[model samples]
Target chain A: MKVVALAGGVGGAKMADGLARVLPAEDLTIIVNTGDDFNHFGLRICPDLDTVCYTLAGLANSLTGWGRSEETWNALDSIRRLGGPDWFQLGDKDLGTHLERTRRLSQGEPLSKIVRDFSHSWGIAPLVLPMSDQPVETWVETQEMGWLPFQEYFVAQQCQPRVKKFAFKGVEQSLPAPGVLDALEQADCLVICPSNPWVSIAPILNVPGIKESCEGICVRVAVSPIVGGKAIKGPAAKMYEELGIAPSVLAVAESYRGLIDGLVIDAVDNSCRDELEAMGIHVLVTKTVMQDYIDRMNLAKETLEFCQKLMLYKGRQ
Target chain B: MKVVALAGGVGGAKMADGLARVLPAEDLTIIVNTGDDFNHFGLRICPDLDTVCYTLAGLANSLTGWGRSEETWNALDSIRRLGGPDWFQLGDKDLGTHLERTRRLSQGEPLSKIVRDFSHSWGIAPLVLPMSDQPVETWVETQEMGWLPFQEYFVAQQCQPRVKKFAFKGVEQSLPAPGVLDALEQADCLVICPSNPWVSIAPILNVPGIKESCEGICVRVAVSPIVGGKAIKGPAAKMYEELGIAPSVLAVAESYRGLIDGLVIDAVDNSCRDELEAMGIHVLVTKTVMQDYIDRMNLAKETLEFCQKLMLYKGRQ
Candidate 1:
């Protein structure tokens, strides 16, 4: 079955990794959020894209869940000594990706094409597309830094900024990246990876017709990042609370109610399934946390099964 | 006495290291060529400036005669696997300098200021100036890659390109960086380090008024890179030969005849010293090839002594 998975970094990459292993390369198309993409040291860096690529290539630093494995940080050290921006840790090897991508981008290659070339280099056979080819940066309007780029807010400021609101710069003029709307349109099932909804998946949804594509035909299911009032990984639950939303699996379902058809939560969040179903949403309770590679595969398999069941029920209607 | 040195990479860096060790930081200023500086993987890489900094900071790789000491290849290896431009040897730690330099330059910081910052970061108290603040790329019109950049010729093609001509792009609009003229005007002597005259030192002269500064007030002396008929390091001799110029010290002196007041040659080229002097150039016949630290310091000292004597003669005049 043709499956389209929406993702960001870290949590999304892990789930994408699981899906890539479980499904045939040709069947899986990963649509990554480009909001985290920013320029550092004059090199274009797509943190989410790189994390997804590295994880798939088995070159990711298992410890950090970001950057390359066996990475040495002499470059960051030198930048720190030079009093340059050392807040964001760009590993020497990891810097190569940004450098090459920036070079290619300067040469007039589109972001999607640049990503395809890098993915091919890393032996990633699955189609990985950015949510938007146009430059769209995630800006966190914070009390401390006023409005800081996502990375500066997240990595540099250690996420300490009291986020007032989030802004997607360039989203107004941005078009859903080539193949994004098509991927959603043609997919037998659409799965949202266990990534942050507001910061990660929101950016993708905001890309004009991308959300519109999922509204009618596709059996869209979101894997809850929040289980038992806590995020599986990252600051999703905290961000939800900061935005004044209840940090729960049901909250995750409520946010995606218009675009999505179903929600999959951890067995620990099985109690919230009734509340979600009461809102006319299909709910599935599974072990949502992917602790290991096998767990990821199992979760992905279960997600696909849930989506297939949801689609079958929709066909009967 | 205040001294200014024209330097390139490796050999020149070694000499600069010795000179910096002997002379107090304030007494020495190194004017490095920027013709070899190019954007690699979108990072502005200044090879000559880096070599000088690494050598001065005692962070130079002893085995390679360049790059950072105790460097890791993880970044390079990953870059290669990612199909990055791996022909140019950029150590993991060394990448930081390029990244920050490019970052600063793109942010509207001048090359001179970036060099000063890098020098300061490495604890190099001596002034290190790029030949010019403007971008001057050395384009080698060659048999292989016609009009390839300097690094493309030297590193990528391994200097195998049959020379047609050397062109420095943007030389006309460029000005010698700040403090460069100050160093030249105030210095007691100037020693042209044993660098390629045509490629390395010529770019500095191409900067408007820089050559004129070296011409009038400074007691300009040159250490010949061409020993007998070959260079101590690099393809200077080969390049000279390919460019239809003889690879002798006399030919080298002839190249810089109008610029130099005196030429320092090896003991083996003592017979040719008279011929060089006959061409209206004062010649110092000494062992100009620096085999070790002692040799580098000794030659620097000898060059200073010759410049001191020339200044005394100037006083008499």
Candidate 2:
């Protein structure tokens, strides 16, 4: 089945990798969030896009779930010694991507085109598209810091500030990248990978035409980022708590309420099944914690199977 | 005695390092050529200034005569793998300097200020300064190509193209960086290091007020880069030959005919001493090929003594 996936960073990359392993090259397309993209050391750095690309190519550091494997920090060390900004950890091999991407971008090449070339270089088969070719900076409205760029709030500040709101700065004017809408329009299934709802998938959905196109898909499913009342990674749970919502699978479902037809929750959150069903959302409570490659593949298989079942039941209705 | 040295890259850095070892921090300032500075991968790279600083700080790669010791090439290797411009080798540690310098420059910090800070961070005692804070890009007009940026000719093209002419694009409008003229005006002696005279030392002389300031110094001397009719390193000899001048000590003396009182030539080119003397220029023939630290120090000492003798003779006159 042709599938389109929306992804953020580590958790999203893991799920996308699982999908790529299960589906044929032409059967899967990953639309990555570009809102977290920022310039560091004067080089354009797209955190989520690089994470997704590195995961798909098997070049990602499994330990960190980001950056490249066998990475060297000589550059970062030198920068630190020079008293330059050392807040952002840019690995030596990872810096190669930023240098080339920035070089190409400055020369007027689109972000999508550079990503496409990078995908080809990494021997990736599945098409990976950025959410938009234009810039969409993610800003966080915090109680302590007021308004800060997403990276400063996330990496630099370590997400200490209480979350008040999230803003995708240029989302109002951004169009879906070249192949994004086409993939959504033609897909049999649309999967929102287990990523942060506020900062990750929300930015992708905010891009014009993407959410509407996704709604036209036969089966739209969202895998909950929060499992067992905590986020698998990142500050999703803390953000939820700071925003005055108890972090749970139900909160995840409610966040994507009108966009998804079904919710895939972890077996630990099975108690929410009845509540979710009452709210007119199909519930799939399965083993959703992807700790290893096999776990990822198994969860991906179950999720695709659930989508197929939803498609069959919808056809009967 | 206060001294100011003009330098370019590897050869110049070696002489500057020798002088730094001999003189106290307050006694010497080295003015480095910035004509070859260019934006590569969107980062400002000052080759000569970096070479001089690295050499003096004991961080330079001894084998290559440039870059940092024990440098890692992971970034450049990855860039090559991605089919980006790999002609200029940027060691991971070297990239940190470029990145930080670019960041500070974009933030309105003068190149001189950044170099001063870098020198301090590197534990370099003597002052190191660029020729100008303003952009002074060296462009080479060649037989094969009309005109190419200095790095494109030197690093990318490997300096194979026949040299026709050299142009410092912004030199006419550029001012000497802070402290350059002050250092020259206060100097008891000025030593032009054995760098490419055409592209290296010439760019410094071309900067407004620098040449005049050097002329006011009590003693001024230059070490010949050409030894036995060939440049020690780089395309100096090739440029001289292409420009219709035989590369020799006499040619070197004539090149600095009016500006210098003495010329330091390698022992192999001592045959031209009489000719240089005939032209009213004092000649100091010595073992000027610096193979190691000892050689560099010896040459530096000999050059300084020669300058002192000239100064005493001028005082007598």
Best by DockQ: 2
i-RMSD of model 2 (Å, 1 decimal): 0.7
Q: TM-score of candidate 2's chain B against its reference?
A: 0.99
DockQ metric for all predictions: 0.73, 0.84
TM-score of chain B of each: 0.96, 0.99
Which residue window of length 10 is worst by lDDT in model 2 chain B? B74-83
The TM-score between candidate 2 and the true structure equals 0.99
> What ranges in model 1 sit over 4 Å off?
A143-145, B143-146, B312-317
Cα lDDT tens digits, model 2, B1-317, are: 88899999999999999998888889999999999999999999999999999999999999989999999999898888788999998999999999999999999999999999999999999989999999998999999988999999999999999999999998999999998888998999999999999999999999989999999999999999999999989999999999999999888888898999999999898788888999999989999898899999999999999998999999999
Writing each residue's lDDT as its tens digit, candidate 1 over A115-199 gives: 8888898889889999988999899888777999898888878777677788999998999888888778889888899899989
DockQ for candidate 1, C-alpha atoms: 0.73
